[model samples]
Every structure is written in C-alpha cells, then in structure tokens.
Target: MTSSTEPSLYAPREPVFPRRVSGPFRRLKWWIMAVTLGIYYLTPWLRWERGPSLPDQAVLVDLAHRRFYFFWIEIWPHEFYFVAGLLIMAGLGLFLFTSALGRVWCGYACPQTVWTDLFILVERWIEGDRNARVKLWKAKWNLRKWRLRMTKWIVWLLIAMATGGAWVFYFTDAPSLARDLVSFSAHPVAYGTIAVLTATTFVFGGFMREQVCIYMCPWPRIQAAMMDDDTLTVAYRDWRGEPRGKKRDGTTGDCIDCMACVNVCPMGIDIRDGQQMECITCALCIDACDDVMDRIGKPRGLIDYLALSDEPVERAGAAPKPIWKHVLRPRTILYTTLWSLVGVGLLYALFIRSDIGLTVSPVRNPTYVTQSDGSIRNIYDVRLRNQLGEARVFRLSVSSDSLLRIDLQGIPDGSDVTVPADSTHLQRVYVTAGPDDAAASTDVSDLRLWVEDLATGDRASRATTFNGKGN
Candidate 1:
C-alpha cells in the first residue's frame, strides 16, 4: 500500500482591507502616526545656529567633513565610539520596550506599520471600507475598478516619493539639496537612494502590507525571546470566550461569534484562534471586542492585553492582577537600569570630552639633522585639531631639557599659529639643541608638544621624542 502525504508549504495571501475602527487604540494610532511622520519629514528642514562655516541643518551627518551635528552637539570622526554607544542604547531600548509591552513598537511606531496604515486609509477612502472592498476585490474588473485602482496607486506613489525624498535630505544641506533635486542637478547617489526607497515603500506599504510583518520582518521571532509569561501581550480569554456559539435560548458566551475582532484586524488573524505569532499586539481587537460586548450588555475584555501568568488566576474565576504588578518584575527593572546607565554614560562623555587635541609625528627619514655649529635639529610634523566653532590662535611650545628650544619653521619664536575652527591644521616645526646646550641624557630624549588656547588659556599636549647628540 502506498501512503499519500502532501505538504502545502506556502499559501496565497488573502488581501486585508481592515475595517475602519473607532476607539482609544485607533485614536492613539492616529496621534502616533502624526508625530512620527511629522518628525521624519520635517526634521531635515529644521535649522540650527552653528557658525558660518558649519552646515546649519539641525541634525546632519556631514560625511564630507567627517562630522555629525545634532543641534548643539558636534561629533568628530575620532568620536565614533559615541555613535556606537548610541546604537547600543537604541538596541537596549528596543529590548526594554519589548519585554515590557510586546510588539508595541511593531504595531505603533514601526515605519512598516505606519505607512501601511496610511496606505490602507487611502485604500478605504478610494475603494470603500472592508465589506465594500471585499466585494470590489471579487468583482469583475470594470471601468470603476480600474479607475479606483489607478487613483489609489497614484496616491501611494506620491506618498512613497515624499517618504524617500525626505530621507535623502538628511544627508545634505536640506534646502540646497531640495533645490538641486527639483532642478535635476542633485547627486546621482541621492536620486538613486530616493528611487530605491520609494519603490520599497510603495511595494511594501501598498501591496505587501501585513505580509511584511508576518514574513519579512525578524522582530516577531526575536521578540518571543524577550517576552515571558508575565509580559503583556494581546490574547483571548478562552476560559470565558469558549463553550461559545448560539444556543436555542439566544444565550451564548460573550464572544457572540460576531467576528468583529477578525474583521477589523490589519493582520487578519483571529485572536480567538489563540496567541499566534502573527498578532502584532495592536489591541485594536480589544477595542472591537469591547464595543461588541457593550452592545450585548456584557463585561469587556473577552480579548485583551493579557499576561499569560494571569491565566491561572482568571481561569480560577478571579480577576487578573493589575498591569503594573506584572510590568515591574525583576527582569524589566534590570533592563531599565542598564538602559538608563548607558544613557547617563553617553551624556557624561559628551560633556567632559576635549575640544582641542594635538598629535605629533617626528620625521624619521633623516631623524636628526646636525645644524651648522655642532647643534642638533629634529623636524616634527604636528597636527592641531580645533573643535571650537570659531577660529582660534594657539601658542605652540615645548617642554624638554633646559637646552632644547621650539621654533615654528616660518614664524618668530613667540608668534602664534592660527588654526581654523572645527578642523585639523598641520605644521612643520623644528626642535633644536645648540652646540653647548645639547641634551645630556641620550640621542632620543622625551619632550612635550604643548598647545595653549590664546583666547581662553586652555591647554593640551602630546608627548614626543627629541633627537639630539647627547649620546
């Protein structure tokens, strides 16, 4: 006898035109969308008051100059550890949020969710709400269908273009780049970036929608690791909802089999099917179910933000514990502490960081040149990094044995070197030991290359070696 077993590895997607919902969660989603999109689109245009030589975009990665400016803060290339710290902090923040509230980031602030919501809003406006959309999707393609489809696509394309266009503005001077873009003179890379982002936003937001969350995104799987039995997640109270369905007396369980929650879900997963990985924990189902419960004169939360640990208590016919009681457990406290410490560490590093630095390289080809009168000279290439927002004069001096002296090659001994602000300046200088004043210790002697801020008297130094004839 032959055994038959067939595997359906993939299933075709069923389009989700989530029905319009009105409740606290829906209202909260709208507010979050406004704030997040506003910040993304408008941030590039915000101006800062950095001095004339600096790009004034409030938040800029000045890659050309190897600097980053965020409001009053400026980061030099050498300070990339600050950037790394910020990235780590962001990762920790995600972990903290995930442990506290499962997939809240996914359902609310994730770009995929926000853009998809906007796209669906546009779709519902053009194609009508869920019921009408379903009918239209099944109907034969007529003029109305073609017209509606075309209109929706065009609007989606505009949104995608705007989204991509805003992103590229962050890389350059926003106003100038925008002008250059409109005149078709912006860099090809900018245009290419915009084009790629626009295509992805259009395809992902308008067509793929929740499929991106279910398949393309890795967060859902990773979040499971962060979550535990006590973590707040959207789930059905099966103890109350089950033993459901219609009876002759019209007295069914609170669920009523209305499918209100399923109909309104963006991911189209029925919460009553138990906690599936597909649920974003958006809690719109809670709103829908509550509304139905109200109409039926029953207590709400047949579907709710449930902690699995509460299952025992609720199934015992007692109320679940308060939300804060679950959220303030030991793991969450530890995560919060770590997040706060990293944040405070970054702040401290920013404030106490040096504003000026010096580095010196001794010329090694002919490390020591014997001057005409039995004196010794060593050529040194010195780089001064001035991190201030304005040009500053610096006095360069040396601290070495009493016999040694400092001489900037082209300047008088007492003259100052004018270093341009927010940049590195290189200078060649000579350290000399006169015939009678040759260093007595050794051929290579330790010395200090000191830079003093002329205006403020702040100072920094680099330790170096002076080549002499003392050996």
Candidate 2:
C-alpha cells in the first residue's frame, strides 16, 4: 500500500565495474598503491639495533612497557605531548594538502583508497574487464561463475588477513609475534584484533569499495570547509563540452555522448554531472576522457583538474592562472606555516630534551611527623627514570630557603640511587627539619628535589611542597 509518488529512504547500491585505462594519472595511482602497500607490509620487519637490552624492531608500539620506539627515538608514557604534537602536525598537513589540491590525501595515499585499488586489481584479474564483470554480475549463477567468485574471494581473504597481520606486528616484536602466531601461542587479544581487521578489510575493500568513501568516511563531508575557490579538484569542462553532440555537423560541441567517463568511474558517478561529494578527485575520469578525446581527434582536458576561480578564464577561452598561484595562496600558506612551525618545534624539543627524569610525590596522609628529637619530618616517594643505555648512579639533593635535610631509606649514605637502563625506580625519601629551623615552624615551605646522573653530570629536579607544623 505504498504510494507511487512516495519517496524511498533507502536505495540499493549499484555495482561499479571500472574499466581499465592507462594514462599518466593511472600510472601515478599504480605507483602510489604499490609503494604504500609495500611500506605497510614490510615496515614492521625492518630491524634497528638499539642495544643489548632494548628491542631491535625499528618501529614498535610496546604497550606492555608503555613505550613507543621509532628507529632511534623512544617515547615514554610521561612524554605523551610528543605524540600529541605529531598528531597536530599530521592534521595540519592534511589541511595544507586539502587546501592546495582538494582530497589528494583521500585519492592518492589514503589506506582505504590503496586497499580498494588492490581489491579491484584482483577482481579485474580473476573476472575479465568492466564489460565481462558486468555481464557476469547479471548472469545466472553457474559453475564458471562460482569458480571465478570463489577464486576472487579466496585471494581477497588472503590479502585482508595479511593486512591484519601486518598491523599487529607494529605493536610488538614482529619476529617473536610471528613465531607465536604460527605456533598458536599468541595472546587471544592478538587473534581478536586480526580477525576484526581482516573482516573489515575484506568487506570494505572488496564489497563496499566506494561506499566507504561516499557514506562511511567523514572526510568527504568535512573537505568542503577545507577547500576554497582556488583549490584544484577534478572537474569537467561543461562550457566546452556542452550541447552534447558528436562532430557530425560543424557546429556541435566536443562531447560525443559515449559515456566513457562514466564507464571508468570507480564510484559509478558521471563526472559530467558536475562536482559531487562522491568524487574522490582521483583523476581516473581525467584519464578516461583524455583517451576518448585523443581517439576522436579532439584536444585533451575534457575532464581534468581545475579550480573554480579559473573556470571563468577557461570558459572565456583564455589561459588559466599558474599552478603556483593557486597553491601558494593565503589559506595554503597559512596552513604550511603552521605545519612547519609545529615540525620545527617538535624537532627542537626532541633535541633539547634531557635523558634524566624525576617525579616527586609527597605522602600527605600524615602531613608532618614530629620526631622524638623535636624535628619535623616529611615522607616523599621519588621516582627516577634512567633513559641512558646503561645503569648509572643518580645522586639526590634537596634545596630550600630554610634548612632541610634529605635522606634515602635504603641507601647507606642517603646520597646515591642507581636506576637500571631505560627504566624508572621508586625510592622512599625523608626530608627532616630541625625544631629550631624556620621550615619546621611554618605551615608550608617550598622544596626542590634534584637528581643528578653521576656519570653524565646531567640533572633533573621536581619542585614540591614540604608540609610543616604551624607556629
């Protein structure tokens, strides 16, 4: 009992079988895909010799030890600001690229795009090209159809599994994890992560494909704000190709109505329909249209990269502005400056950072303990972090306006504490003030706890409050 004029809230997805075409853009995409996939799969296996005690994996997120190691750089839990700065830089870089060349990240280097391209390559291999795939899709299920589908699915599953496997390798020692995985002795969490990633990759890349870009990804919606009139994007020249007709009569437009652009589109959307959110700016349509134009003895660029501001100039049959004009504009320049500043800041911070770390937490339950010798004592838990490759002796010292004495519980001399290499050690510290001292009679006193590495003479300090008995 549905009315014929009623709107349908849901529409079934139309399958897209993109025809293979070779041009500059297509070749560029092939190179990007190969390089990106190679990096993703092989980066975890690369070894970096850190030390005898440290892991040799070049890039690892050691969740067990709360550390992130990338080549020679190591990040500890306390230094999370470094991670935040990198993420900010990444965001700014995305903004810079999107402002200069719209959605270039999504088109060229996005993980989804790379994986989807790989899945399509496999699909085109097992089945035939676009025409063959379309026919096979519409035809009844037979033994040949079953065999082709099964073959494609099996290959897709393998790729997805490998993708998942490569991801987990980044979290731990790759060789050890691989051995554990093979022997079925790895943690259940690892298996769960792999299974989840494999399923998502297979479904998103092979089945969902462009749907992920069109509906699932928020970047498509957010990219509009990041772009302006000067942002270069994939576009069709409706002005030149309008009145859609072949070159039969001398007065007809350039378009032949061959639908070549539509046939090669991975999103199954026509480029001639003008800019749409579904367009990833992949420039595949540009390649397709250029091929058609060359065959028909017409000039290329029936569909190509164009900025909105340059459309008027192009429409008037004049040369458009230079590429640098569009890319080096105010908005892009601002983003670039910000990105550079962040990068430089992070580099400066990394280089100037100290290897020694100190944390002081005062035990406040019994704020001040009065000793039998008429002295005020405060307890502190001091954690010393040794970032060097080997163990070193760290000497403790206390400084204040008033007379204060520092003592370590276990150390005989109460002066030196030895922390293991690349590790933190917690030591109990006692600060005592004689009854006649001004700090012992005051309510609160400023205290500085310092730890100096005896080997390197490098020092770190923590400023803390020393509780005192009120007069």
Candidate 3:
C-alpha cells in the first residue's frame, strides 16, 4: 500500500519554458516554414496565360463554374476521380512517412504546430522569454504589461488577417481580387471568410496551441495504430538516464536532475517520463538535454529519438538490428509501393487526358418517334466540352447501320459547331434510321455518335440506344 507521504506517479504538469536553440532541425524547420508560408501567400498571385476568356490564375477552384484549373490542367465536375486519386495519394504518402519516421509531420510540418510556434515566437519577442513571461503573468496589472499584451495581440491579429487574405486569393483572379479587396469592392463572402479564418487563427494558434495537438487532432490517435516498435520516435534514453538523481563528483548516471528536457518541451511534457500521448516529438527537448549534457561534462542524447526496445538493449550491451531494416519493414514497403503506384497512375491519367469531352443523354419524354416515312427517330441532348484554351470547331456524326443518319435540326449537318474554351455546349441532336435497316422494331438497338475536332481531328464517341415500337 502507498503511504500518504509517498510521491504520486503523476506529477502536476509544469508549464514549458522552452529556450530557443539552433541546430540542423531548427534550420530545416525555418526553411520549411518559409517555403510553406511563401507558397500559401504567393501561389494564388502567380499567373498562367490561358487565353483572354479563361481565368489567368495558375491554380483556381472555380466552384461557381464547376471547374478546377491547375496551371495547364483543368478538371471538370465530372472528373472528380482525379481529386479522389489525389486524396488517396496524399493518404498513402502520410502512411509511408509515419511508418518510416513516426510523427515527423506532427513535430515539424503540421500547420497547427507551425502556426503555434510562430505565435509563441511573437509572444516571446513581445513579452520576453519563459521566465520573464511567467513573472509578468504573476505580477499585478501595470502599464508596461498592458502595453506588451496589446502589442502582441495586434501582431497576432495582423498575422491572422494576412493568413485569411491569402486564402481568399485562391478562388478568384488574384490581381483583380486584390485590387477589389483594397478598394473594398470585393464580395461580402470573401470578407466573411477572412473574418472567420482570422478569428480561428488567432484563437487556435495563440491560445489553444498545445491543446489542439493533445485533444483536438485525430492524427495523434491514428498515429498510434500506424506506429510500430521499430519505428523511430522521439524518446528518452530511460536506461541511461534512470536511477535519476543529482550528479556526483565521480560516481553517477548521465542525468543531473536539471529538468532541462522538461523545461524546453513545447508541449510541457517530461521526456524522462517515457512516451505519452501529448508528445509531438518536436526534438526541442533533445536540444535542451544536449545543452545540459555539455554543461555537466556528459555525452549528449540522454533524451533522443530512438526505437524503444533497441535503446534498452543497447544500454544492456546487446546488439541491435540495423536502422535501415527497421525503416524498410513490411508495412513501410507496402505504403511506399501504394504511394508510388497512385502517383504514377495519376501522372499517366493527366498526361493522357483529352482536351475534348462529349456526353449524350437520350430524351426521356419520347424515347423514340415513328416518323411519317415509316422510319424510327431518336432525340438526344449532346453536351460538348472544350477543355482547351481556345475555341474549337467540332463536327458531329452518327455511326451504326449504313442507313443511319444524324440530323441537326437548328444547325446544319457536318457543319462546324464552335465551343468556347473551358465552356460546355448543349445541343439537341436527332438520329434517324430507315425501317428496313432498323434491325429489330420491337427492341432498342445501340447507336453511336462521334464528335470530332475539325482542325486537330481529335474525336470522342458516346453510345446510346434508339427505341422502336412493336407492330
């Protein structure tokens, strides 16, 4: 039985005081942040010449027009399979990364983590570092503190607003939209989106920081299922650091009970306590521990990223498996293969996709009409899509029995029908078959319609059936 005086297994969580450190990881993080934020803010402004009629924005999701434009590639609402394929590829890529490295995305690449870190940096710049901020929080209200808090809030609001502003640029012609926005002539929906995003960024990045990772994100929950014993995760060298106590002159373990690892953890978790759900595996604690080790004349990596079983075995003088083998395990291989396959398939599909598309729908009201000439006639609604950057002339024809003929009522037969770039044309078409050639009067017979580009000779065909009534 545990006595009242005995220490509880769980200690009250102490707020992290994370001192800034610079290393390879820190440099990589900085570069990633710069690239990601640059792309986010600037991508919508990039222009692609897609003719005068089409939107010039390189990547725009024109939901109102039921179209998506990405540089040279345009996707119609009917081609949602591309979007699905993209999503699948992204998922498989995530799985592959998780299986190989474990939580690197959470630590460095997650938007929440990145934004929260940026907000924290702003707070630190305004209010000073951990100890200073702590002291200010404890002190009574004063003019200096008030001014600092106000400045921090103003900066946060500016950042959040910029984030929102950049997001709105993606949906419209960026330069024109920017001009409209500056003139206050933009849509109210744009303003509403900016307001919502600003509020969320300010609240989540500034206040809800670690809470988002710990409680709100589903990634952490799903990560558990994806991770294995062999996966490399941010971990403490418990075998070497344990029997933890203050260092002596000659006899001692590596740890000096300085709690540097705990103090520098962004999520305020103690690495020495072993892995927990709250750990983002940021490796700031590794930097902290390394600093402490240098100061105490001990080797670094007391708390480091390592495989759980391997670290213990190493401490006990046992050989461990190669890191390569662990990373290239069965699950990782499967995810990698799937990711590659999907990526290749998407690339192939994109390269082979046609600039013209044609779809035909049979008129439902009267499936077939018995003409005065004792022939069968069928009416169809044909939709012609021009996915190119210029208007196209397409010739429509019917192919079935030699006696079958296509008639365009309002338009001339074999005449060039013009379709504007990135636009769809809906036209009424009729197909007629002589009674002698109409294979079966009692049954529906298959008929094919061909739509060909007059200049390029590119063509698309759709099949429909002409219904006939029995005598």
Best by TM-score: 2
Residue ranges of candidate 2 with Cα displaced over 4 Å: 1-7
- Give candidate 3 regions above 4 Å deviation: 1-16, 412-415, 439-442
For residues 1-471, what per-residue lDDT tens digits would candidate 2 score against the true structure? 346898777888999999998899999999999898999999999999988989999999999999899999999988899999999999999999999999999989999999998999999999999999999999899999999999999999999999999999999999999999999999999999999999999999999999999889999888999999999999989988887886668676788888888988888999899888898888998998999999989999989999999999988989999989999998998999999999999999999988888789999989989999999999999988887778989999999999899899988676999899899999999999999999999999999999888877988898999888988
lDDT of 3 by residue, 9-110 (tens): 765444455666666666787888888888888899888988888888899998888889998888888889899999999888888888778888899889
Report lDDT per candidate: 0.88, 0.92, 0.83
Structure candidate 3, residue pairs in collision: none
Top candidate by lDDT: 2
Worst 10 residues of 3 by lDDT: 10-19
Model 1's alpha-carbon lDDT is 0.88
From the highest lDDT down, the ranking of the candidates is: 2, 1, 3
Cα error of candidate 3 at position 10, Å: 17
**Predictions: Cα RMSD each:** 2.6, 1.6, 3.5
Global CA lDDT of candidate 2, please?
0.92
lDDT of 1 at 134: 94
lDDT of 3 at 47: 88
